[model samples]
Target: MAKNKDVRVTVILECTSCVRNGVNKESTGISRYISQKNRHNTSSRLELKKFCPYCYKHTVHGEIKK
Candidate 1:
């Protein structure tokens, strides 16, 4: 028997505000999150609202290349 393929893939989400700002004013790093998405359900890039410690506010986090 062959192993089944995984339907869920891991994706990296990055803070949009931090990228646009070039650098975080309060911190020296960008906010990032790890999540899983269904390949069959969503083919497009994933975007979510999450809290950023560097930004100190909730912002849009978009999926990025690994």
Candidate 2:
């Protein structure tokens, strides 16, 4: 069980543009991504540049609390 905590964890990334600009209101849902990151290597929240289908552009996707 202790070893599991040290492994990469699954995280959800949400589009910053869609949330800040209220673009999700028009669409059925907001853009989200599932990824894994090393807990030991990346102590801080992860952010990545990803494509937002609703926004129709690439935007910064930040980690959200599960």
Question: Which pairs, if any, clash in model 1?
Answer: none
Global lDDT of each candidate:
0.94, 0.90
Q: What is the lDDT of candidate 1?
A: 0.94
Query: What is the TM-score (0 to 1) of candidate 2?
Result: 0.86
Candidate 2 lDDT by residue in tens digits, 16-41? 98889877666877899999999989
For model 2, the superposed segments whose C-alpha errors exceed 4 Å read: 1-4, 24-26
C-alpha TM-score for every candidate: 0.89, 0.86
Model 1 C-alpha RMSD to native: 1.7
Error of 1 at 59 (Å): 0.2
Best by TM-score: 1
Q: Residue 63, candidate 1: how far off, in angstroms?
A: 0.3
**In each prediction, how many residue pairs overlap at the backbone (N, C-alpha, C within less than 3 A)?**
0, 0
Badly placed stretches (over 4 Å) of model 1 are: 1-4
